[model samples]
Target: MAEQHAAGAEGIHPTNDPGTPGGSVDPQSGADSAAPTRRARRGGSRKSQKATGGWGAVREIAIVVVLALLIAFVAKTFLIRGYYIPSGSMEQTLELDDRIFVNVLGARTGHIDRGDIVVFDDTQGWLPEAPAARTNPVRQGLEFVGLLPDSSQQALVKRVIGVGGDHVTCCDASGKVSVNGKALDEPYLYPGAAPSDFPFDVTVPEGKFFVLGDHRNASADSRYHIETGTQFVSEQDVVGTAFVTAWPLDRFRFLHNPEDVFADVPAPARP
Candidate 1:
């Protein structure tokens, strides 16, 4: 009886033991069953992250674009503006269609001076009436941001020959223009173009400027308009001084004021 009981006990195995051949179940075996489910969940999570990342990238792109346009708008509004040369009045120095940057801040702050090339409004009716312009929305928007040139024809560009109370006279004895009794050797005059085809003597009124084009013969600037009483451009009408030629890559250069031309000219005598 003892032998029979011992053999029966040895054959029996705990139901939860994994090492026994006849065990009912093992806790470690459940891990293998759950692995596929965990793997599937991990794959699903990776896909969700990838989808979210795509939208995040688009949001980043949108932010960059908005920031760029805002910067352009701000810079264009208060700092500088762009304009294209529409005529040959300023030729050689600025060709037709040459894009330029104007210093709006300087003009607004009354930083104007003699020998500076400037753009001014046609408030005195210097330009003939222009037909209404047909504008493209895209082009207009670009112009607003200063990415495209300003196409308005109501402005003119010329060098400031006389400012405020200066006495400006043309064709002194040696065929040169004089300012405040000092002879002007204008090397920037268009080849073979006389300083003035006709004589002119005028004292620029206070808060005004006497302007002239480099192409003297072809331009009807302050010189030609003197008799009409529209010769002087009001300081309030000036848009800005052109600081640089910005487009047509090869022509890019700083448009500096003619320092030497006005250097020795004496200031207007006090009244």
Candidate 2:
């Protein structure tokens, strides 16, 4: 009976350790299993960081682009704007399809003087209908931001010949246009082109301007609109003065106002 009790005690106190080789559990196996899980977690964290970094770069680029567009919009609206010349009306000074920069501030301040080349809106029915052209939203947006030339259909460019209350007439004995009795020495006229092909005599009304094109013979400017009572463009319709030729790099130059041409003329006679 004592021998049986001794055997039972030995069975209850078995000496094989669980973590040893050939035992039920191996500590090294558990460590190896856990190592794969840890590697998988590390790889997932790296991928997540990479994705986040890519998105951050895209967001920064978007912000920079938006800021640049906003600055261009403001400059085009109030400070300076570009215009595309569609006709040869102001030839020898500005050519067809030439891009020009206009000073909006000068026009707004009423700094426009005689002999200055100006762009004006066709408030009256002075301009003929324009031919159709293809356009898309993308092009329109570029034009609005001043990245492209202005595409306004009713804009005209001309030289100021007379201001408010000034007497303007064509064809003196020397075949020259006269302003306030002083014949103008117009060197800017197209070669061999007369100041005017026909005779005209009129007094510029208050707050209006008498304008003519440098290419007088080819241009149907104020003269053509005289019979329709749209002879003069109002000061309010002036957009700005073309101060610089921007495109066709070879022909680029600052536009001079030719103040000497109007130096001898007197101011408008007030009633």
Candidate 3:
């Protein structure tokens, strides 16, 4: 009997073992016996990595754009600025639709002198309330970013004729404007245009300037503003001196102030 029992145990099939491959199982069980497939896990990992890389590229591009915009903003606000000439007020020297660059830094450090072509705000109600120009969203964005000139601001450009307590008179016998009792040799005046169509003598007040345009006939400058009780522009209202013509590459040139024009004019008489 002992021999028979030992023989029976040794004869048992290996398939009956639960730990062996192809072992018998309970088919009604709900749980899955196999772990996840390697191929599925690898595919999921690749998708996750690709998604992360795409976002990283987008983040880097955004940072670069922001930095560029900041630099442009600071430059426009403090270092330099651009202006568009909408009218022929500064014609021959700066024509209609001409673009110019102003030296804001020079204005901050140096002084506004006679014969300087300057850009000034329309403070003291010098300009009438004109309708704003229509601009699309893209143009507006470009202007704000300093890539385009801001034409919406009511600014004027003219040469400084006299400054601060100087006596200025128009048509001093020789058809030339005189400053501080001395006549100016204005070669930049428009061809065949008289020094003044009307005669006037006035002393520029302290902290103000008398400005005139090269296109004398077309410009409604200080000569016209006298009746408005604001004949001169405040020194503080000056945005900057225009130093260069930037647009229309064929017309590019430095806007040099003819210092010798004012060389002989005597200083303003002492108070």
In candidate 3 the C-alpha lDDT for residue 247 amounts to: 90
- For candidate 1, write residues 1-271 as lDDT tens digits: 3433543687744455455333345376633333444467689999999999999999999999888888888777678878888898887788899999889889889999988999998889898888877789988987777676566648899999999999999889988889999999887888888898889999999999999999888888998888899999999899899999999999999998888988999989879
The 0-to-1 C-alpha lDDT of every candidate, in the order given, reads 0.85, 0.84, 0.83
Best by lDDT: 1
Off by over 4 Å in 3: 1-48, 132-152
**Root mean square deviation (Cα) for candidate 2:** 10.5
For 17-107, candidate 3 gives per-residue lDDT tens digits of: 3563322333566322222333455778899999999999999999999999888877876778888888887888999988899987767
Looking at model 2, report the run of 10 residues with the lowest lDDT sum. 18-27
Q: Compute the lDDT of residue 216 as modeled in candidate 3.
A: 92
